[model samples]
Target: MSRMILRALLCLPVLVAALAAAPSPARADALHVGLVIPQSGQFRLLGDHVREAFQVWDADNPGAFGDIVEGDDGCTPESGVDAAAAMIEAGVDIVVGFLCTESLAAALPILSNEKIPVMTLTVRADIIGEEAARLGWSFFRLAPRAGSEAEIAADAIYRFWADKPFALIEDGAISGRELVEAVRTRLEERSLKPNFVDNYRPGQATQPSLVRRLKAAGVSRVFVGGDRSDLAVIAAEAEHQGVALSFMGGDALHAPEGELPLPDGTMAVLASGVVPGPEAEAARQAFAAHDMIAEGLRIPAYAAAEIIGAAANRSDYGQTNLVDLLTGTPFSTALGPVTFDATGERQEPGFVLAILEDGKFRRLSVDDASRLTGESQ
Candidate 1:
C-alpha cells in the first residue's frame, strides 16, 4: 500500500506518501479528512455508496489519515451549511464526499473562510464551476463539467454518422433543447450539417410523424437531445414504420424505461462517472474482501482518498497548495490518472458510450458502435 501510494503521486517522485506507512509514535497526529455527504434525503443512497467506499479505502490504507470526521450534507442548502460548520468545528484539514451540488455550494463559502481545500467525487454542475472561478475557491472534482455531455455527444455523432446522413432532434425541455443546440453548433462549426433539425412534442405514446419525417429526410441515424422515454417512443415508432433508423442520445438515455424500452441499437453518451477497469485491481481486491463490488460512486470516492493521501504527503503541504498540485499534476487512481483543469473539472473525463441491448446499457467501443448503428448504410 505504501509503494502504491508513492506511485499514485507521479509528479512527486522524490517523496514517499505516508499512506499505510509503518507506524510511528506521532502517527496519530496525521491529517484529518472531513466527510460530508447526504445522509437523510433523496440522495442518501448516493452518499452511502461514497461513504462505504471511503471507509473501505481507509481501512486498506490503515494509518493514512489521522481521523475521519463524518457529517451529513443533508442534500439541501441549510443542511449543507450545517455540515460545513461541523467540519470547521472538527478542525479537519481537508474535506471529501459532497455528492449534492446544492449542499456543496452552500458549504463552500464557509469552508473557504478557513482555507480548507475540498475534493468532490461527483458534483459536476457548471454553476459550481463558475462559482469556483469567480470566487477562487479551492475545489477539485473527479467528474466532468456539465456541458461535457453535449460536446461528447457531438463527437460521437461525428464518429458514427459523419458519412451517413443523420438528423438532429430534441424534445422541448430545457435540457433537451440545450443539448441539441450545442450539438448542432459544434457540427456546423465543423461544416457538417444535419439532414434535419427539429423539435418534437414530448411525452406522447408514439412518434409516428417524427419517424416519418426522418424517413423522408433519408436519414439512417439520428441524435436525440431528449429523455430516454421519448427516445424509446421514437425508436419504437421508427421500427414500426420499417424505417430502420438508428438513434443516439445524451445522458437522459439512462432513465428508467417504462413499458417501451429503447431499441437494441440505441446509443447514449453518458457523463464519465466511475468506470473502474484493470487499473483498479488493488482496489477491486480490497472491495471483494468486504463482499462489495468496485463500482459506481465507490470507485471515484476511493480515488478521492488516494488523491488526499498523495497530495497531503508533500513536504510543503497545506490547504493553499492543493489546487495547484491537483490542477497542474496528474495522480494515478482506480479511475485511471486523475488530472484537473483550471475549473477543477477532470481534464480527460472520457464519455461512456453505452448501447441499449438486452434491456441494459452495456459499455460500447468504436467497433461495437459501428456494428450497432448499422455501419453507415
Candidate 2:
C-alpha cells in the first residue's frame, strides 16, 4: 500500500505537467463592435445604409466580428446618451456610426469614459474637430469637417466664377449664412468681391422683385446659401423675366434622393465624391449585389468598418487597449489611405465640385469652372 501511494504521488506531478503543456481552449478571436445609428425617424435611411455596409463587409470576411450590438440613437442627443450606455452594457470594444451631429456630441463623454474608441461615419466636421481638441484622442472621424467643407466650397467658387460678377444670397439659416461668408471671405482674400450680397426669405413662391434687384445689379452668377429648392422660386422668376443667371450651392445640393430641378450649369460642392480605386472595388461590388445604392453614409460607414477591422487584426483588441492600438497606424481602407491628422480628422481632399447637367449631377474638373459653365476660361 505504501509503495502504491508513492507511485501515485509521483504520477500526479507528471499529470500536472502534461495539463500545463497542452494548450487551453482557444480564446475567442472575434471582436465586438457597437453600431450606434438611427433605426427610426428621419435619419433611419442613413442608419440602414451604415448597418448594411458593415454587415456586408463582415459576411464577406468570415469570423471577423464576433458580435455586433446596434443601439438606435434616433438622431437625437438624448437617444445618443441612451445608445452609448446600452453599448457599454453590451461589452462592446469599439463603436462605429453616429449619423447625427447632436447624437454624436451627446454620446462622446459616455463612450470616452469607458475607453471605447468611436469611429464616426457621418460628417459633423466642426463638432468632431472641437471634441477631439478638447478631449484628446478618443474620436476618429472619417468625414470632412464643416470648416473643411466651407474652405473647399470657397475654392470651388473662386475656380469657376473668379472673373464673373457673382451675387451671394442666403436664406438666413445659420449654416447657409456661414457658407456664403466662407466663400465671400475666400473671394476677398483673392482681391475679389461679390457684386451683390443679400438674404432672401425661404419658401416664397415668386421672387420677381429679388430677381429684378439682381438683374439691375448686373450679376451674371449667384451663389445660394441653401439647396436647389431654396433658390427655386428666385430662379423661376429670373428665367421668366429673361434674366440669364447661373446658380451655385453648398453640399445640400448633392442630395442622394436628387436635388430640386435646378437648371443646367448649376453647381454644388460635395465634401467627397466616389473616385474609382482598387480599395473601393469590394464595396462597390457588395453594394451592387444587393441593388443597394452606395451614397452618403454608405461609403463612409464601410470605411469605418475597414478601419476597425484593420486595427483589430493588427493588434490585441481586448477592451482597455483598443484606442492605444489605433493611434498612429495608417489604415488602408476603401476610401483610400486614411491617417488621422493631429486633429483626429482624415487627411484628404477638402471637397468635390459637381455640376448639374441634363438634370443630373456630373463630376466637374477643377481646371476651371467657367469653361464648364459657358463662362470664359
Candidate 3:
C-alpha cells in the first residue's frame, strides 16, 4: 500500500477499536423512593407537606437520581401493608413517610422482606429503633420519637419549675400514654414524683371539670400529652378557674403567630427534631429556588432524600442496596446532624423548650429557665 493509504488504514482500525471499547452514553439511573403516607384522608395535610419537601429537594437538584412513588397508606395497618407491597412491586429501593405508628408496624414486615430501607417521619419511638435492629438494617427515623419529646419536656420542666409540684396528664391514646410514661420515668430517675397523674379524652367538652380537678390537686406545673387544640382548651379552662399552670409538650403545640389561645403565664415547651433557625432558613431558600414551599414535614422528607442520595453517591450508584446504605452511612441534613446508632435510632437531639407569648410559641433560652430553677441545661 502507499504510505498515506497505509497510515489511514492503521488509524481507521485504531479508531474503530477505541469506539468499540468506549462505554455507551451514560443513561440517567432512576432511584425510586416510596413515600408511604395518607393522601386521601384526614392525614392528607401531612402527606402534602411530605410531598412538597420531596418536590422541593428534587427541584433544587434536578436529575440527581431519585424519584418518589406515592404509596397511599391511609394511616391504617392493612393499607400500609398493601402500600408496601405495591411499592416493592414497583421496584422502590427505599421508603419514606408514615405518620402513624400502626401503619408503620404493619408495613415493617413487608419492607424487611423486600430488603427496602424505610425512613420514617413518624414520632413513634417504640417501633423502629431497637425493634428494627433485631430484624435487620431496614428502618430509620428522621423525626425524634414521642419518648424523646417527653424526655426533653421533662428536662425543660425541671429547668422552669424545679421546686414546684407538677402533674402528668395523658389523653389515653398511644402517643399520649407513651409521653406520660416517659416523663414520669424521667421524673422518677431524678428522685421526683408528680403530685398527680390524669388521663382525659381529647376533644371532649368536659375539660372544665378536669381543670378544676387539677387545680384542686394544687399542681402548678402540668405536662399534657395531646395536640395543640387540646392543650389550648386546657389552658383556657385553667385560666377560667383562676389557676396559673406552666404547660409543656411536643412540637404539636407549635402554631403560627396568633393561632394558640394560651393565657398569660402559661409557659409551653415544644420538642422537635428540626429547630427553626439559620440552617432551616437556608433549607427554605434552597427549596424556594426550586419553586417549592417549605412545610412542617419538609425537613424530614429532604432528610430522607439526602440519606438515600448520600448512600448512592458513596457507592457510585452501584446496586439497589438501600439496606446496606442505611446501615453503613450516616446522613447529615438540614435538620442538624444525623447519625444512627447500632439500634438504627438516630442520635440527633430534639429541641428543648419554647414558651407561649402573645399567642405564638417562642423558643426559650435554656440559660434563662435553667437559672430560674437552678437547673443545668
Candidate 4:
C-alpha cells in the first residue's frame, strides 16, 4: 500500500478510539454544538449545505450532539456579531461554522473573549489567520490560508516543469498578479525561475500575441495565474496557431466549462478537499445517499462536526481543554486525517495536483503527478 494510504489507515483507528471514548449515555451528555452559518443572505445556499451535512452526521451518529443552536451569520459583520452574541447567550458549548472572512473577523474576538472555541469550516484569509495568533483567539481552521493556494500551484509546476522552459503569465488584475508573483517567488526560492514572465489583459477574446511571445521565448510549459476564461482563450489561441504548449493553472479552472474547452492534459492545483481518497470516497457515497454533491464547504462542515463532537468525547466532555485536545490530536474524518501545526495551520498534504482528462479534472496522487510529461499539442 502507499505510505499515505497506510498512514490514513492508522489515523482512522485513533479517531474511532477518540469518538468512542464516551459510551452509550453519549446521547445524554453529547456536546451542545452551535451551528453558525449564513442562513439569510446571498450565501444562504452554502449555509443550507452545511446544515444538511450536519443533519446527516447527526442522524448517522445519534448521540454526537445534545442540541444544535442555530445562528445566522448572514455572511456579514453585523450578523456575525449578532450570531456570536446569540450563541453565547444560549450557553452553547462550542461554535462550529463561519463561511466568510468578514464573519470570522467580526465575531472571533467576541467568541474568544467568552472563551468559546470555534471550528471554522471555511473563512481562510491572511489577516484572519494572523489575528488568530496575534490575539490568541480560540478557533481552529480546517480550511487552508490564502497564499497556500499559490504555493501549491508553484509546487505542481516545479514538479512537472522543472527542467523545461516554462512561462509564468498573469492577468493584469490585482489578484491575478499577486498569484503569479507568489508562485514566482516560491519557485525562485528553490533556485528555479520562469523563462518568460508577462501580464496580459483579462477577458480577451483571443491571446494570439501572447501565444506567439511564449513561443518565441521557447517555452512549452506554462503556469497561468488568471481566470478560467483567459486561460481557455490562451490555450485555444496557442492551438489555433499550432504552438505546442502545456498549461497549468490554479483553482480558478474549477469553474464551469467555458466557450473554448480546456485542452487535454491541462492541470490545476486544487486543495486536498477535492482530492478523492478512500475517506473522501466514503463521504461521497454518504453524500450521494442524501443526494448532495459534497462541494465547497459542505464536506468540510461535516468533518468539522466529526472533529468537534469527537473531541468533546476525547476530553472529559468539557473538563479538559477543548483547544488542547484539538491541537494535540490527529482526528480522522471521511475527508482524511486532520492535524494542525502550532500556528493552527493545517499540515502537509494540503493540496493535490489534478489533470484535465476528457473534459474533467481528476485528482492525482503524488506518484501520479511525478510520472506526467507535459501534454503535447
Candidate 5:
C-alpha cells in the first residue's frame, strides 16, 4: 500500500504540469482594440509615428489589453470610411486614431450606426460642436477643439496684463478677425476692455501707419489675430517706427516659417502638448527606444489607446459596456486628466501660453481655467 501511494503521488506532479500548460477557456475570449490611422500617402510619416507609439504602449502593457487591430485610413475621406467599416466587420471592441479630418467626417455615420465608440486625436474646431450635434455620442477627442484655442489666447493675455492696458488687432482675414473677436468677447466677460482695437490689411511690406496709430494710443501691449507673417511685418514695422510694445497672438506665431524673427518675450496661445511631467519624460524615453520623436499625434495616439484599454479593463469587455465606461468615467493620461461631456467634447478644455524665442515655443506657467473662461490660465 505504501509503494502504491508513492507512485500515485509522483503521477500527481505530471497531472498538475499538464493542466498548467493547457490554455484557460477564458483566454480565448480576449477583447480587441482597433487603431485607425493613416498608413500610406502624404501623411504616412505621422501614421508611422502613431503606430510606433501604440506599439510602445502595447509592449509595456503586454496581454492585459488584448488584441490590437490596425486599420489604415490613408489620410483620405474615402479611405477613412472604408477603414472604419473594415474595423467594424472585424469585430473590434473600440477604435482610436483619426488624424485626418475629412476621414473622420466620412467614417462617423458608419461607426455610429454600429454603436462603436471612437476616440479621435484630430484637433479640428467643428468636430465636437457642429459635428457632435449631428453625430451625437460614440465619438470623443483627445485634443482640444480648434475654436477653443482663441479663448486660450484671451486667457493668457488677461493673466499676463491684468493691470496693464492692451489693444486687440486683426489682419482683416476671417480667421484673424474671429480670433480677435473671441479674445474681445472673453475680455468683456471680465469687465475689462481693450484700450484700442484695429484691423490692418494683410500681406503689406510694413504697417507703419497702424504701428504709429497704436503707439500714439499709448498702447504698450497688443494682441494680433493673424498669422506669424502678418505679426512679423507688424512687429518689424513697429520696431522700425520706434513703437515699443509687447505682442501676443494665437498659435500662428509658433510657426517656424516666419518672414522675420519674433521679438523676445512675445507670447502666444497654443494647445498644450503633453506637459513636461513625469509621465511625459517616461514616454520620451520609450519613444526614443524606438528611434522616434514624440510630438504631434504621437503622444495623443498613445493616450487614446490607454483610454480605450482602461475603459475595456473596467467593463465586461462588451462594446456597450465599454462605451458607457468611457463617457461616464475620467481617464488620466500623460496629457493630463481627460473627461468628456455628453456631446463628446472635453470638459474644461484650455490652451497653453507659449512664449516665442528664436523661433521656438517655450511654454509659460499658467493655471488651468474652466472652458467657459476659454483659457487654462
Candidate 6:
C-alpha cells in the first residue's frame, strides 16, 4: 500500500508540471493597450512624438505592465473606428491617442460600447464635457479644455491691457470660434469689449485686405486663435503693414522658441496644461536614453504611461482590477500630482503665460504683460 501511494504522489507532481507548462487562462497581466494616432498624414509629426514618448516610458520601466498595440487612425473618424475595432479584437485593456477631435468622435461609440477607456490628447473641450458624458465613462482627456485656456487668455488681456484697445482674429474653425467666443464672454464679464473681432480663413493666400482692415480699426493688442503657421503668416503681414499690435497666441504658439518668426516687441502668451521646465527636462533626459524626443502631444502620452505605471506598481503585481486603480488612485508624475475627476479631466490648473522677447518665448508671470506692454512699468 505504501509503495502504491508513493507512485501516485510522483504521478501527481508530473501531472502538475505538465499543466503548468501548458497554456493557462488569460488574465489582466496579458492585457494590452492600443495607441491610435495619425501615424501617416498631416498629423504624422505629432503622432511620431507620441510614439517616441511611449517607447521611452516602456524602455525605462521593463515589464511595468501591458503591451502596446499600434493603430493608425490617420486623423479621421472612419480610421478611428477601424483602429478601435482592431484593438478590441486584439484585446487591449485601454485605447490612447486621437489628436484630432473628429477622429475622437468617430471612435467613441465603439470604445464606449466595448467598455474600453480612451485618453485623448486633444484639447477640444466640447467633445469631453458633452460627448463623453452622453456616450459613457470610457472617455478621458489629459489635455486642458479649450474654453479654460481662452478664459485665461481673456483674463490676461484684461489684467494687462485694461487701457489699450484689443482685437481678436480667429481662423473660423471650431476651436477658433470657441476661443473667440470664450474670450469675448470673459471680456464681457469684466465690462471690457474688444475694438475689433474678425474671422479669417486659415491658409489663405492673401491676408493683405485683412491686415488693412485691422490697421484701419486702430487695433493695438491682437489675440489670434489659430495654429503656428497661420499665426506666423499673420504676424509677418501685420509687421509688413506696420500694425503695432502686441500679439497674444494660444498654446499652439508654444513651439520651439525660434520655430516661428515674429516682429520685434511682439509679446504672446501660451496656455497649456503642462509647462516644459525642470520636471519636463528630467523626463526628457530619461526619454533620450531610449532615443526619443518629448514634444507636442508626447508630454501627455508620457504622462499617460507614467500614470498607468504608477497604478500598476501600486496594485498587487499581476492583479486584474485596473479600472478601480485608475479611477480611485492618484499618481504623481513629472508634470505634477495627477488626479482625475469624475469626468476624467485632470484636476489641475491650466495655462502658462509666456512672453516673446529676443526671438524666444520666456516664461513670464501673469502680470508680466502689464509691465511689458505698459509705456512705463
Best model number under TM-score: 4
| Candidate 4 weakest lDDT stretch, 10 residues | 368-377
Overall local distance difference test of candidate 1 = 0.79
Error of 1 at 59 (Å): 1.0
**lDDT (Cα, tens digit) per residue for candidate 2, span 1-377:** 69999999989999999999999755436779999888888888888888898888887776768888999977778988999999999999888888778888888888888877777876565756776668874787777667776677677667667788889999899989998898788779988888899888887777877898899999998989976676766777898999999888887776543234678777777655343345677778888887886775777788888887776665355543666666666887777777876656767753567777777776675544547545535
lDDT of each: 0.79, 0.77, 0.72, 0.81, 0.75, 0.73
> lDDT by residue for model 5 over 117-166, one digit each (tens)?
77777645664456765757478777777778877877776766666678
Clashes of each: 0, 1, 0, 0, 0, 0
CA displacement after TM-score superposition, residue 153 of candidate 2 (Å): 1.5
Question: What's the C-alpha lDDT at position 127 in model 6?
Answer: 54
Clashes by residue pair, model 2: 125-145
Q: Rank the candidates by lDDT, best first.
A: 4, 1, 2, 5, 6, 3
Among these predictions, the greatest lDDT belongs to 4
For 178-207, candidate 1 gives per-residue lDDT tens digits of 889999999888898999998999999999
**Where's the lowest-lDDT run of ten residues in candidate 3?**
269-278
| Candidate 2 Cα outliers beyond 4 Å, as residue runs | 1-29, 123-125, 256-260, 273-281, 315-321, 366-370, 373-376
Regions of candidate 4 where Cα sits further than 4 Å from its true position = 1-28, 373-377
Span of ten consecutive residues with least summed lDDT in model 1? 20-29
Each candidate structure's TM-score, on Cα atoms with residue i matched to residue i, is 0.85, 0.82, 0.77, 0.88, 0.81, 0.76
Question: Model 1 shows how many backbone clashes?
Answer: 0
Pairs clashing within candidate 6: none
Candidate 6 per-residue C-alpha lDDT over 1-377 given as tens digits, one digit per residue, 9 for 90 to 100: 69999899989989999999998554334347788877776888887877787788887877765688889877777887888888889888778887777777788778878878888877456555576766565777777666668767887788776677778889998777877788888888889999999988897645788888899998778888877667777877877888876788777676653444765555444534335555567677887776666656677778888887776565353564565567645776656566776667766644567776677665675466556667532
The order of the candidates by TM-score, greatest first, is 4, 1, 2, 5, 3, 6
Clashes of 5: 0
For residue 72, give model 4's deviation from the true position in Å.
1.4
